[model samples]
Target: MTSQYKSPRPLLGAALYASILDSLKAWLKSDGLAWLFAFKAALAAILAVGISMRLELPQPKTAMVTVFIVMRPQTGLVLARGFYRLCGTMVGVTVAMTLIAQFGQYSDVFIALTAIWIAICTAGAARNRNSRSYGFVLAGYTAALVGVPALQDPNAAFMIASTRVAELTLGIVCAGVVSALVFPLHASDEIETTLRAQSSSFFSYIAKTLPSRKAVEDVVAMHEHLITSLVNFESLRVVAVLETHGMRSRSQRMKRLTSELMAASTRFHILLHFRNQLRLSGDHQTLDTVNRCVGAIGRLLARSPDVLDTYASATGTAQRLDRLRLRVQRHLAYVAKQDGFTPVSSLNLATASDLINRFGTELSAYVHTYASLQDERHSRENWLEALTPKTDPFVALAAGARAAAATLTLGFFWIATAWPSGSTALAQGAAICALASTATNPFRLAIQIAGGTLIGGVVGTILVFGVYPHLDGFPLLALAIAVATMPGAFIMTRPKVAGFGIGYCVFMPALAGPDNPQSYLPEAFMNDAVALVIAMVVAAAAQALVMPATSLWFRHRITARLKAEIATAYGAPLRGLRAEFENGVRDLMAQQLMLPRHEGLPIRIPMAWLNSVLEIGTAIIDFREAAADITSRAGLSHLGPAQAAIRAVLPLFKKNTGELRSVAIDALRDSMLAARLAADDATLLPSERSRYRDLLTALNRIKHALRDPQNALGQTGQPSVAAPSSR
Candidate 1:
């Protein structure tokens, strides 16, 4: 010991080494991923350029630019994007060639037709979601690039289109190959990690919030997070399926899992809503009983034997939930037989039991589906329906019109001015307009891209004029290009500055025009740079002034769509209806969250509308299911009043007049009375009575939700507690 203590330097050195190792590990998990992405992008760009140069392609820079555009952190994303980019390019080139052959003699006709094509593509892009949308964007911009340059020389149109397609193909292949082979990050792995994390976090959130009196703010935040995670998971699943055959085979199962998750979350929200209503009504007895049942559920989730971070763990959790489901059923049955329970409390208990049971069923299904992913022998033949996304046709049309207007205006200006780089400017403007069509804040994105293009132009000017002149050979050129493009590639990994990075990385290469024999013309470089900047500004102006998404009318349209979900719930077919309704409403909610607040719109309006939609839509689904059960067994004659009540409320959503509200309220009251009478009938079977009671609970929930002053359909805009009262 004395000899070891003789020198503390060794100990200090060991401690320092351990600290450095920890720091390195932390960095590798966070910023290191970004650094790795940047490195891969740079390598792909260099490879694209080197091959293009060797093959003597017309424009090596096109291939290089394509590399930056398609490069992503995950192999699946890169491959998916490359595939879509290829498709878009082929379609675009074909259209460009046809347009040139037909309208080349008339510049005005060609420009107008090209603008129309861009408009259609832009609309398609805006209407679609995720990677498919990128295909539409490329289709629009590719046509512009191919046709705009060939307007002056009709004979060269075929040559230009073919060469452009070839360069793009080369870039796509190179990017895909490099991304898949070198330090590859698989989307499957990402999906697994995300599923584990989201499942665990969501379980914890439900456990903590279910039995407690969490604030409204906390619930709202959780709602937002859940919606975001739902959207991201779907996007990741799309790309992951494209990456590997195994993932492709499991696509239906994955969709089923997500759908189950959505259903389970909706059940949780409904249960929470009922709980809050009871609490606000000062029905402590009912509230306590509901809380006790919910608390039991919370305990089961909190003490789950598995962490739900792996397939094995999820399997274990599914088994646990199944057992809990049975135990809860028995417990609820025992509670139902107990004395001293009021009618309202009995109804509340029955409703809570149904919701908790449904939640357990969905959660178990979700876990089983997730666990099945590990079992290749599991049956994959059954195709499960996925969430259907809804897009507003009017919004899409407005976006397309804006893009078309911008293209036509820029094209006419270019022809009138006859500037040397006017074609380049027109192409850039069309590309920007198409690309920004789907953006939440197109004007802001355009401005950011414009700023980045300005910076890219300066960097390109310096590199071409100052650095490239002194360089020789492909290796030196590659090195210089890598050095110049790495920062932008790194920036693209960040969400806040991704648009800027995209602008810089793409425009830099276009501005430099690094061909087989480098064009070092300073005037041309300056003109292209100025033209791109002006194009971006024009795109921004169009986005800001032409049917801006942030306008009051646009927000109202979104609000109207949300309100219509109740009608959808009433009319849509019951098969796979819940998933579709939930997905559509949540999608609209996501869109509403993205729009900036207007002077005429309060910040709470969207959330209020969202709560109403979830509450009323879900209740309608439950009521319909119960009605179907009753009709199939006995008859709908017993529940005629309830059906009438639902129909009455449907019209109130369109026009919230006082008269309509009063009629809806009266109908709901009569329906509840009829259900209560049916439940009390001695002639009814036990199972039949339970069904009628469940129907009554659903109607009561809808009534309370409507009367709650926090929602859009409430009688007053003021916030107040909703006291329980018998009409």
Candidate 2:
């Protein structure tokens, strides 16, 4: 009894140790990566400063600031950012030299010309996406860095430009090297891991959504998440291509896989739309049939956690999907012969069958492309089409005008006041405007930037006045700088505070102005710091007040663009039509989601518009395909009413008028009648029969989608027409 009782304390002690160890492991897995990234960033900043000081550059802080600006957790991002920064710097330097040479004698003219250049670069930044946007940002800011200082001393413009370029190059090189060599995190590995996770989650999503009665809002949220993941994946892929030869070789396959995923997702969405329509119509028999078929496919898509872990397993999944596709076609024929199906229900069943078959085909292709990543001898496939993002020209132009206005306003202030730190203010404001132009909510980002700069200024002042005076050597200087910056670097890893971190790390060294023989002029430091803060405040105001993207009018404009995607489906070339249409509409939706929500605008309006666009656009594409097949095999003469029906709806896509909607619905009813008559003709060849039947299905889907009371088109008064009976 004594021995048994004595062992309980030891057991409890061991259990407690185990629990603590587990907690530590969990923290390491989550926050540990961020800590590692922070350490690497600090190391890069130190190396850049050390190199710049050793080279006896005029200001080592510029180099240090550049390191923080470009250093990322992954090697590929660092390299890609550094490469673009160098390019932008070169372009900016060239432009600055030209502007200074031409207008340096006239300060007003020089300032105006610099503002124009900044405007152009800002527009480019807003127009583009991903790292390419960073290039435009740098181009806009570098001009200010070079031209503002050179305006006071034109003779030294070349020297100023050269030094800036050299410092930036040194910083870029250091960041790239450190990121690649020191505890490297390759983008390829991240991509692979992301692919596995996304694939698994997507499979689960399909399994859950297919046969269930999930709300439309839930589906929309998931769709938004998937679209975001797709965009992020593309960004990672671009950087991965720059990081390793293996990734470069596999780039086409990766692109192909993305395209396949997009296509497959679209098909699944259409399938869901049909099932939803069936359920809404209260056609329990047809809905049950569709559910059973969909549930079977979902079960097959249901994958084990490690299903995508190996190429062989993925290949097996692909084979199963291929077999399922054939089975679906046979099942479609069986469903069509069932006696209880009404005309509308039959049409719904056929469309659902077609969608499931197409989805399976696309899913199989996606799996095959994924598996091809591990195969060295995989043949080159046709290049997958790139997503054509629909950026509003007005939005881009407004961003440009805002940046230019901010720069010109600041420039005038500098000239009017003739403050010693005016040049610094102008440069800092221009950089702030240009860098924040592409942000979803530039005003919020500007506020974060201002806060970060304030903190950075305080830290820099203390370090320069209090800490640096006691420091003796470059190593200690490096140590002090690293210690000061590491927290900001760590903050950078958390997206919520990333803007603050960026502002802190970048502006801290800049405010300190650490040089070879560092000058600690408390007065000048205070002046520069105050100027920088005021400039950021002005930039923030401009972002919020000057054609703010968050405005109701801007949201309306984006909504208009989202609706216009149906026009793409109607008129765009058939080649890559589906991908282009889907990406364009989804991209606009993504942009809309990025804008801060307003009380006046219900999110449901845009969500409804998105659903309507996808439903109608997809039907139009299928209608076109079926028409093309029927036209080639038979003739377009019989399909005239269907074609007319599609044309009638195009105008309604822009502005859903009751009159236009009624006309479209009438045309659709007539077209359905004509298509049924054509299909019933015994003279029709067996080969041509299926195409005509497909045309009817597409028309039926379009008509039903338009009639749905939940979408943008439905808000219009109902059509004053009657449907033909199945009997």
Encode model 2's per-residue lDDT on 1-727: one tens digit a residue: 8865676777899999999999999987678888888888889888888888888899888888899889998899898889889889999999999999999999999899899989999988888877877788899899999889999999999999988999999999999999999999888988888898778877888887875755343667667778788878888898899988888888888878777887787778767876777777787787787777778777776645556788888888888878877887888788789798887778778777777788888888898988888865477445667764535677887888889989999999999999989999999999888878888888888888888899998998889999999988878987898789999998888887788998898888888848877887778888999899889988988898899878887777777777777878988889889878877888888787877887666666777788888888988898887777674434556778658888888777666777888999999989888887777766777656777788788888888787777666878642211111110
Clashing pairs in 2: none
Candidate of highest lDDT: 2
The lDDT of each candidate is 0.81, 0.82
Give one digit per residue, the lDDT tens place, for model 1 in 1-727.
8975688788899999999999999999889999899989989989988888888898999998899889999899898889888889888988988998888998898999999999999888888877877788889899999999899788888888888998999989999999999999888878888887777777888888875754333556677788878778988998898888888878888887777787888777777877777777677776776677778778878887355867888788788878878987898889888998887787777777777788788878887888888875577427567665645777788889889988998899888999878898899898888768878777777887787788899898899899988987878987898889989999989888788888898888888848877887878888888899888888888888888777877777777787777777898899988888888888888777777678786646666777788889998998888877774334455777657888888776677666888888899989998888888877777777778888887898888777766556775542322211210
TM-score of 2: 0.94
